[model samples]
Target chain A: MKFIVEDAGAYLQIKVTEARIDAAIATPFKDKLREIVVKHRKPVHLDMANVTFMDSSGLGAMIAVRKSLPDNLAIVLCAMTPNVERVFRLTRMDRVFDIRPDAIQKEANE
Target chain B: MRLKAVVPPKTQPMFHRVLDADPVVVRATLTDMRHRFARDVCDDTLGRLELVMAELMNNVAEHAPVATSDRLPVIHLCIVRHQAGLACALADDGVSLPDACMLPRSLPPAIADNLPEGGFGWFLVQNLTQALCYYRASSRNYLAFNIPFMEREDENLS
Candidate 1:
């Protein structure tokens, strides 16, 4: 999995470049996220535009990341595909994060 | 009435099919599970698949020695309608229930079955699936499990 961080002024944009997020990939995925926070601690506007699938491990990693962030820092998940959204809804996590499916290109217009 | 030729009941059960034990197989298995057991399964079915798939795939990856590059394990599936429920089977050519798995365990058993310990998978197989059964064939192992399949009659008939 790969992560791209772009400066968004108020909130940092973290884009995940991976097809699947499951047990096989959770280790490195979490490690990298932790590293990103240590270096660039701030509110994250996560863009999961490329993530096709996510499992419990991935969700665990995401929640862990959410809890570890600096206080007052917010995390927003944007561009969740149908499959990813299903997972969030099943776990009732959609209520926990600010989730939206607007495309990355739409970000500029808004 | 002319008697129709008697056919054998399907030994393979209902809608069950065999597929190769590869990473890509998870997609198909999960798809089938979702379609056939829609009510019994919830959105978390994908996570269940992830946990089961990880253990099975790891069994093959950890134990299946390759004298030949093409000798990966085979996974067989069978779906059966139990008394008041439904179940599926996943058979493989990997070693039979890791010997350490069938023994008495010290942990909570269900959640910690996949820890790094050699037999952690046994714990998972036993707990994740509703009813877990194990048997070893000549050169293969079979796991049969059954879980509750919710029904409209559950409330009305009860």
Candidate 2:
């Protein structure tokens, strides 16, 4: 997995690429986000604008990222695909996050 | 990491799980996979392999063209050390390797936006693993990969 960092004023936008995030690779991905949290400590706009599939491993990684925040940072999930969105809804985690319906390609460019 | 302990010390340090290739089991499978890894690999290390395997199994079960048998697909997992990395494999008794070019070229917008919900599984599987290979001999499919290996207690992403 690879991350593209974008400074979006108050929130740092993290564009995720290579899609699937799960157990086999969660450590590095989680560590990168933790690095961001410690270094940036601002509202995070997780531009899922580019990610397609996410299993529980991916969800767990995101939750890990959330837990690593400075306690005041907000995470906004934009452009969640049906499957990925379904995971959040099923896990009742959608309620824990600010999930917005953003177009896949359109939102990423923004 | 030299694991020479021959006895079951007070702490059981490993977890193994097997699940049917049903969609309902995806969440539980992931939860189980994470709990197993949480003791070792931290969130910052790498998290795609587990996701990749789950996606691969889901794709085999849900997307691959169903044969006349319509038998449920099987997924087998085994964890071992390869040098300084963790080696894992997810094998199935369904379809063969797909066109490499047709692999999900880009990470889609979100799971919800994938209108037909068909291609995301392959897209997801290919993206998660560090090294990926598909074997079609012996009338089955074997998918495998590896990730950096680390011991337990150091995995707090926080």
Candidate 3:
């Protein structure tokens, strides 16, 4: 559930620090991300490079967060590992979410 | 003096664990199980196995009937590496699994306005594993399935 959210003026960039998003952290992860997105009211770019594993529960949490956002705002998933990517691909959620292949470069932002 | 020939140990890899039906414990068990056969199986196969196991085990944790005491339901899980696939068996003393889970399932329809958050667990479980079977005996539920190994490119060529 450890994530660092940076306010990038026009949008927000979130880097999830945890290695696995399983049933253990899915609820809190959804709640926290939903809170951040609702408060900021900005498009979000979720950096999922660190997450090596995600189950159906984790995918459900991500879907919940997506549903919480305003119609105009977007949640873009970035740099998902193979394990995390498999869940989305198998469930066909990849078609629903805006998924990008590049990681949010921390150094370029600074 | 004639000495008997030494017997070599079993070479196949396997894993077994007994844990409470809790999300945290389920996560740890899946991680350890991956490491147990990481060398024997490829990552593609292991990842599929891990996902199926997580979905099945977490369902038990999420659906544990309300108990008067603080005790959690118990789950027993075992996995063995086979020639063509990884065989998995799980038994839990939780509520009886719904009959619909074992039936053929498709992904929840993707509605544009309001997407479904849940209902994807059993779909993923049914999609990833082969010969999935379930039964309830006594007070425990039993589930068994196999995750077939991905056919390697070299194997396909040969």
Better of 1 and 2 by TM-score: 1
Candidate that scores best on DockQ: 3
lDDT of each: 0.62, 0.61, 0.88
Name the best candidate (by TM-score): 3
Candidate 2 lDDT over residue span B1-158, tens digit each = 99886965343334455666665565467667766766556553335545555666666656445566666666666654344456777666666766762354543344331222223445544444457666677867776676654564234322
What is the CAPRI rating of model 1's predicted complex? Answer: incorrect
lDDT of 3 by residue, A58-78 (tens): 998999899898866988999
Q: What DockQ values do the models have?
A: 0.11, 0.08, 0.82
B41-151: candidate 1 lDDT, tens digit per residue = 443443444345555555554566577546677777666544444566777886556666655443322222222212334444454466666789787887776644345
Give the CAPRI class of candidate 2: incorrect
* TM-scores, all models, native as reference: 0.54, 0.47, 0.91
